[model samples]
Target: MDLIEVLQHRYTAKAYNPDRRLPEEIVAQLMAALRFSPSSVNAQPWHFIVAGDEAGKARVAKGAAGPFAYNAPKILNASHVVLLCARTTLPPEHLQAVLDQEQADGRFAGEEAREGQRKTRAGYVALHEQAGDLGMWTQKQAYIALGFLLLAAGTLGVDATPMEGFDAEALDGAFGLTDKGLAPAVIVALGYHSDADFNAKLPKSRLADSVVFSRA
Candidate 1:
């Protein structure tokens, strides 16, 4: 399909056919698309809880029941459901390597790196940030992943509904992720559409073109 046509036609499916399933290879390709998503200092902060089994999917479905819980069977019918969990802590090795690279490139230099550290710390002490350098970077990384997943699903002709309409702690525990230190930020339900679930009824909302512009 044409690139614009694919995106132009995208929409979130509210209901789904319980028998639909996505191939493993297709899921892998979707993740491959995620690899290209940009992140601050390349500290990819997201980790996924692949919940495809009946019990696991049921657990998530029950926990997320607002307008989305009704379609639990439809999503369960998919080959798998992905729980987008983000580690609250920066992966140590990734940070070490990034800091090492910056140190080597002399971009931060020794004293400048020291100053950056000081400023970052100040951001926390003065305004309440934690985990120092990792705090800001980690938050930025999650958003990058979210955007990537949206476009990747679109590219594959798969319908997805990205949601933030549930409890995070409840989801974390249901997925047994507290031990893993990952927090659930978004819940996206994915699969092939059942015609009624198509974007036919939804129009994209936007700010007026005149209401948007560049500073430069």
Candidate 2:
């Protein structure tokens, strides 16, 4: 299907068929999409934890307990769940690591090019740090990846539900993300909708283009 058609039909599935599992090939494509997601200055300050089995999903479901109990079924029943995480801090070592990977990937023409790339990335990181929004900035980058994953799922005829109603603190503790310099930003459930999914029968609703867009 075309992009327009996919966008028009895609909806957040409220219930999933637990028996359904995504093909390994499709899961690989989705992982690639997340890995290559664009971020400002190519900061790539994000990590993804994907749960594809019963036990793995149960661990991710821990965050959905108590006040977030409503979302537990979605996580548990879905074929897979992805926990999107953002870096808690962007230190100099992380910047160096990015630069080193770029160089190893042949992204530089020479040492001069490598140095220039390093300086540019550092400048942006410093700016965010000075603004006292480094953490927010990283989280925004992770959301960009989430958007990519959602669109990729739609194109692949997969039902995806991007959820943020879980308890982040609980999730971090469950995953020991803090010590790893990471924090949970969002979670997404992927699978085929079940017969009980009432949302499948609903019409899509959104504001008119005129109200949401500007000519300027």
Candidate 3:
């Protein structure tokens, strides 16, 4: 299907068929889509924890307990659950690491270009840091990756539900994310929707273009 059709038909899956599993190849494609997601200054300030087994899914479901109980079954029964994490901090070492990888990937022409890239990216990072919104900036990048993952899943004929209903603190503790300078940003459930998924039958809704857009 075309991009427009995918956008028109894809809905947030409320329930999933536990008996169904996505093909391994499709999972790989989704992983790649996440890895290549665009972020400002190419910060890539995110990590994804993917749970594809019963034990793994149970662990991820910890975040969905208590007041977030409504979302528990979605994580437990889906073929896979992904906990999208954002870096809690962006240290100089992390920026250097990104620059090193870019150089290794032939992204620079020479030392001059490499240093230039480093300065440019660091300037943006510093700007956000000084504004006391560095953490928020990184989480925004993680959401960008989330959007890419959802779109990729739709194109691959897989169902996806991007959820923010989980408890971030609980999930961070469950995965030791805080110790690793990471924080849970969102959770996504992936699989085929089950018969109980009422959302599958609903028509997509959106505000009209006139209300949402204007000529500048």
Candidate 4:
């Protein structure tokens, strides 16, 4: 489908067909889309936890206990669940790693371009650091990847549901995210929708463009 049709057809899949598992090739494409997601200054301060096995999905579902119980089944039934995590801090080394990869990938024309990128990226990082919400800023970048994943899933005819209802702290503890300097931001459950998914038949709703956007 074209981009507009894909957007029009896609909706949050509240229930997944447990009998239908996603193919490895489709999963690879979704991961590639996420890997190429844009970030501020290309800091790329995020990590993704992909849960495909029963044990792994169960572990992730545990994070939805108590007040978030509604999300547990969705996570468990989906072919795969992805935990989007953001780094607690964007350390200097992280930026250096991105720069190193850029150089190796020939993204820089020369030493001058490489140095320029380093300086510019560092400046943006410092700016965010001074704002005193570096983690929040990082989480915002993770959401960009989330958006990319959702769109890619739609294009691939994969049903998905974006979730922010889980316990972040609990998920972090369950998956040892803190020890890895990562914190859960959101989740995306992916697969084919179940026959009983009422949301699949609901009409899409959105505010009119006149109210949602404006020309200066």
Highest-scoring model, lDDT: 2
Candidate 2 residue-wise lDDT, 124-193, digit = tens? 9889889999899999999999999999999999999999999988898789999999989999999899
Model 3 spans with C-alpha error above 4 angstroms: none
lDDT of each: 0.65, 0.94, 0.93, 0.93
TM-score per model over all chains: 0.72, 0.98, 0.98, 0.98
Q: Look at candidate 1 and give me any clashing residue pairs.
A: 124-129
Candidate RMSDs in Å, in order, are 5.1, 0.9, 0.8, 0.9
Candidate 2 stretches with Cα past 4 Å from truth are none
Residue 149 shift from truth in candidate 3, angstroms: 0.6
Scanning candidate 2 in windows of ten residues, the lowest lDDT window is 167-176
lDDT of 3 by residue, 122-150 (tens): 99988998999989999999999999999
Taking all chains together, the TM-score of candidate 4 against the true structure is: 0.98
Tens-digit per-residue lDDT, 1-216, candidate 4 = 689999999999999988899999999999998999999888899999999989999989988999999999899999999999999987878888999999999899889999999999999888888999888899999999999999999999999999999987789778999988998999899999999899999999999989989998
RMSD of 1: 5.1
Q: What tens-digit string does per-residue lDDT give for candidate 1 at 1-216?
A: 887877777777676666777787888877776656776544456776666667767777765666655556545655556667666665446456555665676666568765675456344333423535544555456667877887888888877776667666567667777777677766677777665654647786668767797566
lDDT of 4 at 73: 87
